[model samples]
Target: MSASTAVEKVNLREALLTRRRARTPAERESAAEAIALHAAALPALARATRVAAYLSLPSEPGTGPLLAWLAGRDVPVLVPVGRADRSMDWVEHTAGAVESGPLGVPEPSGRPLGPGALATCGIALVPALAVDHAGNRLGRGAGYYDRALADFPGVVCALVHDDELLPHVPHEPHDRPVDLVLTPAGVFRPSRDRDV
Candidate 1:
């Protein structure tokens, strides 16, 4: 990443996070419901034998409803646990115990299935600050998801607000673009399909 591009990503992330924090609780709740509906109906998600997902922070679009919907169908869901080395581990979402990870992100308290466990899942629903029509996603700058999805073969999707689906987002060559984007409005493929 160029120095300018790195700065741009930082600024974009701050602005997006601020906007998210400004949302009313009711607005967030409604958006979450809509996003759940949009995502749960995806053919790829419907066919997944296993899923890799995240537990959204309060300010981000809620994934609780969608996770619940998946659980209802008996889909085995794995949520990420961030490690000190900035890598991620997958743990089954048992909906039992919960604890914060190294990054302060909520993680399933179950035994980790290791990073390679992600390969077993058919699709991954990842978090993003914003994404472009080309599928370039602006994450929170931790490089956790970027590294995790770098060589991932399955479908990788991002969940963002309707407005966060931008016409473009500054991206680096190493940035892993998403194959699909899920928003409150609907689920969308990038302007062009990206090879998995």
Candidate 2:
């Protein structure tokens, strides 16, 4: 990536993180509820027999509600456990199957299902700092999701706050794009020529 693009990503992540950290507990709870409701209504999520999702950090939009909602419906959920190679491994997110993962991120506490497990998921709820109008997603800079999703053909959704769904965000060629952006307000389906 160009130096300017890298710089832009770093600056954007910092700005977004600041905004997330400033949210009050009540706002977080409300956003979490909205996200869960709206996301659950998504056609992809609604139809998927199994979906891949991650636990949200305190600052990000919560995924616990969505996970529970999915599990309650008998829809299996796969949660990521970061790997040493910057790849992601999946595990069934059953009750009590979460523990403090790398960098304190909550992850599935079971044996990994390996990177190939993502293929079984029809949709994925990925965390993002922001998503651009063109469907480009700005992640937390480790490139873990990008690498893990390189060959994934499922519906990719990024869970972000309403304001974070911007018209533009700097991106590199290696960055993976999301097919949908699920915020509290609604879902943004970017124009992409793909059969999801």
Candidate 3:
């Protein structure tokens, strides 16, 4: 990473940590609003026939409004269910029909989807603790998303607060970068090249 990028990363990391420490219920609510507004700006999301999204946890970005909006649009939404080894399994969800899974993340009450089923999705909305300009994503330090997202063949975006958009994030060659970063402010292209 460039020196400037490294510095930015440090600053962003600090900002996120500070915010996380001081986060209030009202702040989370505000962040949720921002996420909805920014997600609405993505035309691909509306046009997508199938989408993958995560169930929100405390301190993570919220998906309630986004999921509700997508349901209103009659979009097929999928949420991740944790597996035995900390990997993810996707399941379809309909409005007012979600259930709590092992990790307390909301999931579809219907049958769970296998890994092969996720390959056909047109969009994947990932959850993240932080993301960088290069598309590098820092999740909750788990490899679930990194592994599950490998087969996704469409637009992959990470939902995060504006403060979570870091200038750089630690990554390995095996890590996957999201195509876009969706925040309340707007949708940002993490990298010009989509291949990353």
Candidate 4:
């Protein structure tokens, strides 16, 4: 990472942390709506056969509507189940098949599916606190998604509200860049200028 990029990321991280602490319930609700609108507009979502999406936590990007749409279309939907090392495994889930897990996140009640299961998915909707124009994602500082997405060779998209798509995010070498950014406005192909 360049020195300027590093400084920019630090500022973004601080801003995001402050924003998360200050967000009201209404703001969160609006953010969820934004996510839904953007996700619904993405044509790649309709073409995906298998999709790996995150199970939303209270403050995270909401996936309920998107998951429901995918299930209605008979597309295979999977949610991540966090492992011991902050890595994750995808598991199939449907409208009535999810149950609250130990961590309070919704997960599939059936057997855990493997990472290889995402091999056929044309798109994967990843959750992020913030993302940059270059696609560097700022998660909650846990490297789970970063590690989990390491092998996904297909389109990896980050879901965030328009405001969350900030100018920069605190990123390290291990952090992965998303191929696309899905915001309430539309889908964007992040600039490749910052590629490592």
Local distance difference test, per candidate?
0.91, 0.89, 0.78, 0.76
Clashing pairs in 4: none
User: lDDT tens digits, residues 1-196, model 2?
Assistant: 8899889889999999999999998888899899999987888988998999998899999887888789889998998998888888899888776789868999878878988999999998999999988899999999999998989989999999999999999987888899999999998887787655
Worst 10 residues of 2 by lDDT: 187-196
Clashing pairs in 3: 34-184
Could you tell me the TM-score of candidate 2?
0.97
Model 3 lDDT tens row, 140-196: 556888898876788889988887887868776667889998887788897657742
Give the per-residue lDDT of model 1 (tens digit) for 1-196.
7899989888998899999999999999999999999987888899999999999999888999999999999999999999889999999998857888666788889888899999999999999999999999999888999999988999999999999999989999888999999999998899765643
Angstrom error at residue 92, model 4? 0.5
lDDT of 2 at 104: 90
How many pairs in model 2 have backbone atoms within 3 A of each other, for residues 3 or more apart or on separate chains, i.e. clashes?
0
All candidates in order of lDDT, best leading: 1, 2, 3, 4
Per-residue lDDT of model 4, residues 1-196, tens digit only: 6798667666776877677767777777776777677777677776678888877776666677778777778988887787776667777876777778766777777787776776767788888888898888887666778887788877889987777887767688889889888776777789975221
lDDT value, candidate 1, whole model: 0.91
